[model samples]
Target: MKRICILVIVLYVSMTLCGCFGPGISDYRYDLATGYQLICSSAHEIKVVPKSSVGIPMIPAKVVEIVFDDTFILAKQLGLKKESENSTYMIPDEKVIRYWIINAKENKIYGPFENDEFNKKQKELKISDSLKLKDVDSYKKSK
Candidate 1:
């Protein structure tokens, strides 16, 4: 019947659309000492803890999009070799002044923002800061 055919067509279209917007693959982590955290989806959707007056208060994170070249600069700043295969680096506790997001895919730098600027940018983005930093145990669990 015509109704049956229409129902089947609608079902097929719905299934197709669902597939297009399926769940994304992402990685999340936090730095042990500074409590800086990052969530990366597709190497583009990167979010970090916004600068705040309180030290290590785990809320109000900010999102920034970085490009590929920034990764190299970050490595250099962190005393990493440009061609090193290692992906993660930790900063000394005393030097943990600002957090940054390096977009490995596009090679752009996003942060090094002061607390006030970071918070301002977060407001401009209009994104809720629901993401939280993973403690040492939680970070280890992910690995």
Candidate 2:
């Protein structure tokens, strides 16, 4: 009876231990390779909101690499007003624009255009209480 009990306990322990080595997400995924789906935990998805001098243009984007990935990122914006005198188009009906990226979570800026004054109104936005970035070496030692 004692041997039987020990065997049952050992089998239960082994079964639990075997599950620990099951499938787990790696740091990165290579979808192009092996022709199989890959999921990664470390890889993060980000989006950029491009801007133009005239205003925000309609463009489709998929991915972007952030220079710095920190919880607390600061965003500075500027507003532009277009004036047309005598229909001469002082600002030109179509003016050149520059593009910049916005966070994926930030969708208000890309929500929709109410009127021509969309880009004319600029505001400052920031994300606080985010985990600041640290070098790889420093991160390993961090608690």
Candidate 3:
């Protein structure tokens, strides 16, 4: 019984130290400044939360990817609309990839838009076309 208890304790301690049961930030990347961070907390959740330097920005849905990062941040979020229970429109849920942008320079944020709307907003904001969205995994691998 003593040996069995010691073995169980050792296993639990090893797992905990290895982060198997940790619910902490798994991926964190910088955007524009030191205080600005794009974070993915917990491997199981698999979502990104942009932490702004200026103030707290609220994001409604789970962000899947951080597409662009500079003075401005563009992210792909999961789920924006849901089909009404009684309505005719059958909008798919979670299948749609919504876009969100955060202007760290100006402390302004815009979000949860379709592709066209996002483009239009980009143009309106006079953001440079040179800055492009990137594949998060590929970008990480190259570094």
Candidate 4:
């Protein structure tokens, strides 16, 4: 009986470490575009997947909000850069809000850029100036 118990314990630990018992996605926020989704794996982790499919390269972020037009998706996110680089954890290295852009037509994604960099890319991409990030403070208050 003791040997059987030990075996069971080992099996459970192995499964847990291998992600067989990992946290499932807690929420899914879909885009109007077919197959685009923002999945909240946890409060601190959001994943942007192409075609709503896992295993493809995705943008990892903690999203405050996302807006979409016919051509593009703009998300106001935090921890995007850190999450993308370090796949092992979902913690935010910095609490800074950054802008990420996705070109729906091309199926391409752009940076978790700072204000200056985002502005530069904004012009280069010809993203409409009217597309604005909703104020983070206001979002928090409303929530």
Per TM-score, the best of the predicted structures is: 3
Give the better candidate number (1 or 4) by lDDT.
4
lDDT of 1 by residue, 62-139 (tens): 233221121211211111122234745322233334544333333344556665665565455443454332322233
Tens digit of per-residue lDDT, candidate 3, span 1-143:
99999999999999778775544434544343223454444332334443533345644445556655457777666663435767754332567778877776665679779989989998998878876665444344210
Q: Estimate TM-scores for all models.
A: 0.29, 0.23, 0.61, 0.59
Q: What digit string (tens of lDDT, one per residue) describes model 2 on residues 55-143?
A: 43222221211122321122212222245544532231222322232332332233222223323322333333252323222211111
Inter-residue clash pairs, candidate 4? none
How many angstroms is residue 11 displaced in model 4 relative to the true structure, after the best TM-score fit?
Answer: 27
* Per-residue lDDT of candidate 4, residues 6-42 (tens digit): 9999999987777645555344445434456656656
| Model 2 / residue 101 / CA error / Å | 13
C-alpha RMSD between model 4 and the true structure: 7.4
- Write the number of the candidate with greater lDDT, choosing between 2 and 4: 4
lDDT of 3 at 77: 69
Compared with the true structure, all predictions reach lDDT values of: 0.38, 0.30, 0.59, 0.66
Residue 2: error of model 2 in Å?
0.8
> Which candidate comes out best when scored by lDDT?
4
Report the alpha-carbon TM-score of model 2 versus the true structure. Answer: 0.23
- Ordered list by TM-score, greatest first: 3, 4, 1, 2
User: Which scores greater on TM-score, model 1 or model 4?
Assistant: 4
* Model 1 ranges with Cα > 4 A deviation: 1-95, 101-109, 140-143
